[model samples]
Structures are given as structure tokens and as C-alpha cells.
Target: MTTAPAPPSLPAHQQPGAPVPLRAVGPPRLRALDGLRLLAALMVAAYHYGGRDGEISDAWGGSPTHQFPTASQFFAYGCLGVQIFFVISGFVICMSGWGRPLRAFFASRVSRLFPAYWAAVILVTAVFALPWVAYEAVSPTDALTNLTMLQMPLGVDRVLGVCWTLWAEMRFYALFALCVVLPGATRGRVVMFCAGWTLAAVVAEAANNSVLDIVLMPEYAPFFIGGIGFYLIHRYGPRDTTGWAIVAVSWLLGQHYAVTRLWHAADLPNAFSYRSSFGIIAVVTVGHLLVAAVALGKLRWANWRWLTVAGALTYPFYLIHEHLGWVTVHWLHVTLGLPAAATLPLTVTLMLALAWCLYRFIERPLTPRLKRSLMG
Candidate 1:
């Protein structure tokens, strides 16, 4: 992966007017990781509505397809990308909190995550609630829940519509913060928590409808726990190809099962039969391992300067493209009438352009300023 920019060499006893050399701090930059983020963002964007009629068909039989295997099945499996994000989040967040006090860790996380999210939520709600749009008006309770990032626990859907993942992330942050605060908690604590959370997910699934159901859903906490495990392994475990092999095998098995089942069940009206338990564990484990392999791998050509930049902008892209609204997709469908084959490429290109512009003009400059203000 691409290493961070090197600090300039400075001579000792330089003149007072001499420019000082900047020093690199924290962990070295990982370009491949950013590339992975770019891939995830693209997968999510394409999966949203980048096909004919702007809908990726589920196994429940939503639409007709020209081919024996449709693109929607691929997209359905692609939702694993979000789980990938959760794992990455766990690793990155823990690294950030390593050796830090709980207050500082919490502050840093809140500062990084909440500002952009709050802005997006406000902007989306305002745009959609316009009288001309005729979108459903969000109730006060919904707005409050979103603002507090507690909508998942409250059983209210995201006000920003695409922010359901944020609920999971916020919960993960809480659990992680607790780990940081505890006096005797080692890396093992993180593993135990993850295992416990995974078990809780299975129990919640079995129970069907209860408070535990919300907490233990694979979509909610398991991936985050997996990420924590990944961090522990990276920090303490031996670096070898064995981990990579296990990751690859798990990924293929999980992906194959999900795809085959979805494809076979496509004609069924209620195609939600595939269980999430196996897929969740497999994907989360594989996703982190893939990332770790790339980060620690010995590939000399893995570094790409631009990929790091793209990764930094990935979050903004995700936030923007996901909230473009059904109307945007409808407009494109009516105006262009593009076939499914053309939809994925076209939408991805457009979304990337928009995301890049937003990053360049808005998010990039603000991120450093916000960090300085918050951290300094």
C-alpha cells in the first residue's frame, strides 16, 4: 500500500527564519485500504438502483430479467460491503483509541462522525420535506431519534434514510469506549465481546421480536466485533499467509452460498429465506482478513497515491449518493431510458464525479480545520 508522505529532513540549529520540517505522526498511510473503501462505495452505489427500473431484484421476485442470472443477485450479495465497513470501523476506531483515555476517544469519534452526519441528515430532511417533493414529512420524534443517533434502539428508521448504518456504528462506539475505559480489559475483552455479540445475534434471531432482536442483529454489532478481532490479530498475532487463506476460503463459501440461494429463490414471492447468521460471520471475518492482508502484505506495487485520496472521500460519496432519493433515479429512468446493462456504469460514473466534487470543494478543507479545532 501507498505509504504516507515522508517528512522533510531538517538541519540541526537552523536559522530562525528557516522553514521547519513537518513530521509524520500516527500510523502510516495505507493506500490499498482506501482502494478497498472505493470499491465498497461503488458496490453500494451500484446496488442501490443502477439497473433497469432502478431496482435490484431480490429473490422475492420483483421484476423480470432478460438473462438466466440477473445483476441484482450480485448486488444483493454486495451488501456485504457494508459489513466490511463495520469491521474496518472497529479496527480503525480501536487503533485511534489505543492508549488514550475514554473521554478523548469518545470526543474524537463524536467529532469525526457526528458533524458530517448531522449536516447530511439536516440537508436531506429539508430537501425531501419540501412541499413540491410531496415526500412524507418526518415527525419530531423521528428527527430527534436521528439527531441522537438512537433511531435503531427506538425502532424508528433513519431520518436520513441511508443512515441506518450509523446507528450500528454509534452502538459499536459505545461498546468500544467501554473497552477503553476498563482498567484490566485486554485485547481478549474485545474478542469476548464480539463472540458474545455474535451469540446474542443468534439468540435474537431465534426469538424473532424483542429488544435483543434489535441489539444482536448481524447488521447491528457482529461485524463491528469482527473488526475488533481483526485489530487484535493484526497487533498481536503472527503475520503469515495462513490468515489470508482462511479469509479467502470463508469469503468464497459465504458468497457462493448467498448467491446460489438467492438465485434459486428469485422466483419466490417471499425469498427472504436465506439465514444471515452464517453469511454475517463469514463475510465479517473474510472482509477484515482481506484488508489486513493488503495492509500487511509484501506487494511493492500496492501503493497508489490517488487511491488514498479516493478513500478519504469515500464517506462523503457514500453519504451523498445514498440520499439522492427515488425521484432522482426515476428522473434518470424516464429521461434516459437506459437498459440495465448500461445503468451500473453510468450511475457509478455520475456518483463518483459528484462525490469527487463534494470532497474537493466541501469536505476536504473542513476536515483538517475541524480536527485542529477539536483536537488542539
Candidate 2:
């Protein structure tokens, strides 16, 4: 859900005559993907705290009086936006480090993930557990476990539920990094690794073992694979129908995973009744279509300032939105006398304000330096 911006090399237009740093090289910006990132963050925030589904998103169809309207449906399925982020992450990770040294690749990814993440972790800890000046308190262990951002894998609960996605993201990074660091990276090898991984995931699912789900998180493999497939198609060429085929297969499997995870799983209060079987299919289909459109050069824009700003704020926005927003809503509606209807805008505005501060202060300033120090 969060992307650390990579250092940009100079634009071709300003390269020849201008004095630019020798080590400076920036990946070309994909404004459309950036826009998508912004949208995904907002969607998840809406899905979590903004929607009538209540604080927990899985309680989607619970509010009988509000019933499920079109707006409700949008909020209910908003977490699907994370699938969009996963696909984008695969694309971004590839685009960010094509042929770069493995060291540089690692440094870039570390820089992009941990600095802001750590800061967000600290802020969220204070807000959710250790509010400096006010509010109720939560477990200290949760705050500590969250600082690692590996709570699930570490056998500790997360300080924030949304952080589960980060573990999935980290696993994808580890797998992709392994591919990039092979003795001699080749298209076939990368393809083989991703395909093999997806196959393993399928097998794991088929085995019906809960342990593999906890350890591997293979259920999400298809999205990452689809992302890599699209990246191959874009970076190499469209004629690579092989890559296109992988993407297609991945999309199909994603829908399949959705069905089993959401529909067949006898979990949740209502079990299979929580969501329609078709809802998951629709989400996967639409997500891939967006990725396809982006790869086809359809969503390109000339880097409008507003879009750039929105994109810049995405990572921090994602980091701070969920728990903090819910806390704010509780304060406004429960603690204060404000009605639920009146508290929604205030909650959103408060989260945005907090995100802006985090981006400007911690995320923006510290990331490059942290990366540089690690590289040094």
C-alpha cells in the first residue's frame, strides 16, 4: 500500500546543458500508476473506517437499515484496491531496478519501505496505544510488534490490522530480489521463478493446509505474478504473448483464490453469506483490466502537479489512515456529541492532515538519507 519514491535521474530534456549530478538517475514517472496509488489508498481508507461496514471491513453486509447500496458496494470491496497496489508494486519494483546491481536494488527497496514505515509505526503506536496527551491505551506489545512490521510472522499481533498487507509485500520483495540477484538474470529464469512460485501457491492451496497459508501467504502470489507479467510486456514489448498469457492465468487464479478465501471459507459471522461469490470475481477482473489499460499506454498523463502531489502522499496516507481514522471517528462520534454523518468528513480531513505532516516530515526528508546511509 506504500511505495517509497526512488531517486530520479535527470529528465532527458534537461540533461545536455544543465549541471546534473553524475549518480543521479530517475525512473520515468508513470502518472497514471501514481494516480492509481492515490485512489487505492483512499479506497482502502473508505473500506476500513469511512464506510457503513463499520471499523472492520469484513462486516460489509451487516448494516441492515443501510443495506447494501451501490455506494456500500464500493466501500465493501475497497480493499481490492490493495490488489491494484500489489500489481503496481511488481511493476514498480521491476521498473525501478532493471539491470541495476543487486546492492543498489536492495538499498532502493529498503529506503522506500522502512523509513516511512518506521515513522508511521511510531505515530500509530502513540495514537492507538500511547496517546501522549489523551485517549485510551492499548497493549504495549502490539506497539513493539508493529515496529518490526512483521507481527504476523513474528507470532505477535499487529498494532494495526492493515499492516498484514506489508508482510505480503515483503515476501514478494524477497522473492523478486532473489530473482534479480541470480548469477545471471535472464527473462526465462525470472519467468520460471514466478511461474514456479505461482504453481507452488496453487499446490499449497490444494493441500488445504493452514500452516502454509500462515507461512507462505501464497494466496496472493497470483497478483504479484500478474504484475511481473505486465512489467515484462511493458519493458520488453507487447509481442511477448507468453508474458500476456501468464498475466491472464494469474488473473484467473486470483479470482479463484477470492472465491475460496471469501466464499468457501467457513469463517466470519455469516460464513459464506458475508459476500456474494461473484463479488470477488468482479474485483479481480476489474483490477487486471486497470493494469492492462496502464500497460497499454492508455492511462498516461503529462504529470500534472496535483496528480504528483496525490501520488507523493500515498504511502504516508496509507500508513496513517486506518487506525488513526477510526480513532478520530470514535472521538468525534462517541466521545463528542457529533453524529456519525457529521463525523465522517472530519475523520477523513484529520487523517489527511496527519498524513501530510508525516510525508513532509518523516517520509519525504528521511528516506533518501536512510537509503544513502545504508548504501554507504
Which candidate wins on lDDT? 2
For candidate 1, list the clashing residue pairs, or say none. 2-303
- lDDT, candidate 2, 66-132, per-residue tens: 4334455456566778887888887777666556677887888888878778887777667655533
Candidate 1 ranges with C-alpha deviation above 4 Å: 1-26, 50-69, 130-145, 181-185, 188-209, 215-220, 237-267, 270-289, 298-300, 336-343, 365-376
Q: Cα lDDT for residue 153, model 1? A: 67
lDDT for every model? 0.57, 0.70
Error of 2 at 12 (Å): 20
Listed in order, each prediction's TM-score against the native is: 0.70, 0.82
**Residue-wise lDDT of candidate 1 within 1-376, one digit each (tens)?**
9944433442331221222232212456666777778877776665565322223332112342332145554454456678677657766776566666665665677666665566566766776677755356578678767887777667785766557777677767776677554432344454455556656665776687667655555434544554555555454443323333333443444344334433443355645323254554565456666766754543336787898788867886787675553434434444466554555455556666766766666566665666567666
As a TM-score, model 1 comes out at 0.70
Global local distance difference test of model 2: 0.70
* Minimal lDDT window, size 10, model 2: 56-65
